[model samples]
Target chain A: MTSDVETRVVRIIAEQALLEPSDVKMTDTPVDLGIDSMGLVEAIFAIEEEFDISVPFNANDPQGSAFDISSVRSIVAAVKSLVADQTT
Target chain B: MRRVVITGAGTINPLGASVPATLDAMQEGRCGIGPLEIRDVDRLSVRIAGQVGGYDETAHFDRQQLSLYDRFTQFALLSAAEAVAQSGIAFNGALAERAGVVLGTSGGGLNTQDDNYRAVYEEGKNRVHPFIVPRLMNNAAASHISMTYNLQGPSFTVASACASSNHAMGQAAQMIRTGLADVMLTGGSEAMLCFGGVKAWEGLRVMSKEACRPFCATRTGMVQGEGAGVFVFEERDRALARGAEILAEVAGFAMTSDAGDIVTPSRHGAVRAIAGALRDAGLAPERVGYINAHGTGTTANDRTECAAVRDVFGGHAERLVISSTKSMHGHLIGGTGAVELLACLMALRDGIVAPTIGYREPDPDCALDIVPNVAREARIDVALSNAFAFGGLNAVLALARA
Candidate 1:
């Protein structure tokens, strides 16, 4: 079952990757989805705008960032966690 | 073809206000980046920058001159005055007609634009200052320098982002080399430390809130800097005839485009520029002893630049000393290559190779002799200054001891 956060995250990533939301899978990474470094930054910005959250992602050291962008599932989970924190 | 030589050089940067002072700071590896003291500082996420401290425009210029001279123009004029004085070449008669000015600046009067924009939008003001157009124009600095020096020859400005200085100086050198001009005042200046400037760069996410640590394992990203560097490039024969002191010979210069990513740097593009410069100068790869790298402290730039150096120099890369003065003075963007060229002069003339300060741990990816933390004394015959800008533009300049 796709939650609201997961659905929105997939849509945003799909928009940046120029793919259909259905084509984006939970296990897919940004590179696997053909998203470049700039595309990833834009996708993160879209996610931030959609969820009203400031994503702490530095393009210089993306791997060392706290906001996981390894896979779609990780990003969705991180967004969900951030949303939860905003509520509390 | 005529030969070109740098007769005089002057600078006003975060590192120092004069050439001697700046060299002293580079020798000591002093970091000039500190908390920015601009208006609305509390609003900015990134607060540190290489801002020229203790500068008061009123002290240097009258109220009437301040109306026409933006911060960028002021910096350019001040540096040009110092350079002209050092060269001791009074521009009059035939020399005035043959000499000109060429300056580089990415953000021309950005502070002026920022102020007027705020006045109209944020404060709901209708009318702006009348001289806004003349004050904010990109060619204002070059025009002012030409007017001040009575240079009636070719004068213009170049805006190639970070590579602006190199491109401008390259054009100046070409003009002299081709015998089209006898003397050209060339360099770059940038004053983008305003609120709008910082806000725009903050969106790029390539700025470090702390220190700029280039070629280091713990490097964060580049920090913005603001300043100006000016030099008098004269034909060798003319300089010798006048008995003027030659700083360094402008051996060669080359520029190339990556035709690749808009943001990401290409190693091949940098490699070609470095090789092209050496070829233009008729310099062997082994003869080059020092390089002032375009080390912006960002992960992508440092790695790509290091790879490019390794690809170009191969075995000699290990022995040649390379350092990024950006770590000490911060990245001046358009104005950077001009200031960094001072490091090359120091190496070729003074035997002082400036250090890449704030280097904590070595990044294996950038495995070069970075001259980290401490300045080194080495008699170098040839030196290179590298400038790679966004949009894939790369420029390199080679200099020899005079």
Candidate 2:
């Protein structure tokens, strides 16, 4: 299930940057994938819609936002946790 | 005391794309408000706006520049370019350090926000463009203008709803007066006629679905417009030294909050600002011959504005040739006040008073001489441009012949 989250998050990030999923590394941040602040927001919105989970995020203060967006793997882990928290 | 003169001015509004073009339309009493031309027009109950005609993004910007500039920013830059061209001031050394950009815009990049929101929420897109943050920030237009012009001092934005431009210009004028800056590129821009823009305005119920007929008995409500008006404000001595063509003198400005209603306007607040502006300019109420009114075509606004004029001007109100150009250009919200200031300049510079078009029957509540239907030639030694916002904020500027 955690692996499923990883695959889905990786695919979404790759799609946002118009890159192949295989080209995206788990260690890469959104900026590493050529995603800008605007693209990051779009990716966040897509993720929120995809999982039906509300992500507490503020683009103006991304570094301090509750949503973990440091790396692709961190994002997947954060989403899995949020989904679990929402379902419970 | 330092005097501020308008050395250059430019605008891309519903009336026209340039200062001369807009003034010509105003002189002809042309109606610039028409059918809405945007996406999802069918969903909106109101379908009319003062849209800029014959605008081509590709014609104005290359692909690279287009990616960074939003509609509002583009309008600001284009209008500022015209103004700066007219001024012919080279911002190279000390001038660049002392000159800055201050602009007003209520909805900075609403079109960009709406498009991206639709893409993610409706189309389920995974990514938005990378420049969204820069494209959508409220200060984006001012920042871009500063960067383009190489202005290094006091660049910022003022957002006070409809009074945004007036407040911004007033701040710029003060900055020049107080020795903060020598010159300032100031005015306002708005591009809020998109799907989301109209959708949000629909909730207000202050919009007219047909036309903007300000001060008319059959007036319905206000109409939204999108465009920009920019000006180069310089010190009088500097302009004289450089032999710049002075358009009009920005004599005095005053701002006052109604401290009353969120939507409804306050007569007391409006009167205070008007009288305060005259006082600030050191002119008697009788000295003013023309007034550019903030007549939004709404029932409450026109009546209240008239009452305020009467209260401040007394017997002089009957002799004052007050008119609302919004009847032609619609209400540009944050950008309206700056655009209307052009009419005041026309009165001062060209001795032409732009008329309030679309006026039918006169309401008793608004019994002042509203220079109806046709432009009039008048010797306007002193003119006032009034802007009263929805949040009970009021700003008034007094202008004189240069």
Candidate 3:
């Protein structure tokens, strides 16, 4: 089941990758989508704006960040968790 | 071709207010960064900076001059006065017409802009100060210096973000080398530690709140600083003939654009700039004993600068003593290179290499003798100063002992 958060995350990532939302896959990584470091930052910004949550991602050290950006599914899960934290 | 050399140098930075004082601070490996003392300090997330503390504008300038002089301009004028005094070159008839000023600054009168913006937007004030335009213009410092010194030829300002100082100095050297000018007053100044300035940089998320630790694995990011450094670049023959004290020879200068990312620094661009400077100076890689790195303490900048140094110097890279004074004084943005050049002068003339303070854990990626935490005494014949800006612009300068 694609939650609203998952759908929005996919759309944002797809926008940065310059592809249609349907073309993006849940199992695909940012590298698979040809998203560069700057592209990833843009996608993070878009997700933060859409969800109104501050993403703890530092562009200087993206890999060490707690925000899981390894795969689309992982990003969706991270966003969902952050949204839940905001609510609770 | 005529040779260019630095005859006089002066500076007012967070580390100190004069060349001797600044050199003393650098020799001690002292950290000048502290909690910023500005308006609305509670509102800023990144509250620490290398600000010029205990500065009173009224003490330096009269009421009439203060109306037209911004903080950056005041710094430039004060430093330029010291430099001109040291050079003993009275710009009267011929020298005045032949000499000029070239300064670099990214945010000219940013404080003035921030103040007026607050007055109109935040405080709901309508009328603004009349001299605001003259006070806030980018070329205001250069113009004021030119007017004060009666410099009537080839006066201008350079604005290339972080590489502004190096670019301006390089142009000044070329003017003297090409017989366009006999004397040129060149350096850089930046005073952007205002609320609006900090707020804007906060959006980029590259500032470190705690400390600036370049080449350290525990490093977070860069810290903002504010100050100015001014110098006298003159033709070698003229300076020798006049018996003026020559600090260091402006051996070579080269600038390159990355043409890649807008914000992320490129290793290739930095490498090429270093290599080009060496080629221009006719110095071998091994002869270069010290490098004043454009080490902003950011993870991306430090690693990339280290890689570039390795690529250019190869085995000699390990032998060369490199340090980032920004660790002590903070990054002055456009004016950083000008102040860092003083480190090169100290290395060549005083035989003392500045240290990169706040370095705790070393990063394997930046494996080199970074002169960490303590100043070292090393007699170096030649040194290089590097400046890499946000727009992928890179400038490297080579200086040799007089």
RMSD of each: 1.1, 15.3, 1.8
Residue B91 deviation, candidate 2, in Å? 0.8
Using DockQ as the measure, the top candidate is 1
Task: Give model 3's TM-score versus the native structure.
Answer: 0.95
Task: Please give, for residues B49-142, the per-residue lDDT of candidate 2 as tens digits.
Answer: 9999889989988998888899999999989999999999888898999999889999999999999999999999999999998999989999
Q: After superposing candidate 1, which stretches have Cα over 4 Å from the reference?
A: none
Give model 2's clash tally.
0
Clashes of each: 0, 0, 0
The TM-scores of chain A alone, one per candidate, are 0.98, 0.94, 0.96
User: Which candidate leads the pack in TM-score?
Assistant: 1
Candidate 2 has what TM-score? Answer: 0.82
Which residue window of length 10 is worst by lDDT in model 2 chain B?
Answer: B201-210
Clashing pairs in 2: none
Tens digits of lDDT, candidate 1, B174-206: 999997889999999999999999988878888
The sequence of per-residue lDDT tens digits that candidate 3 reaches over residues B306-361 is 99999999999989999999999999998899999999999999999999999999
Give the Cα error of residue B236 in candidate 3, in Å: 1.3
Cα lDDT of model 2 by residue, A1-88, tens digit: 3487778888889999999999998899888889976588778878888888877664433655578899998898899999999989
**After best superposition, candidate 2 residue B218: deviation in angstroms?**
1.3
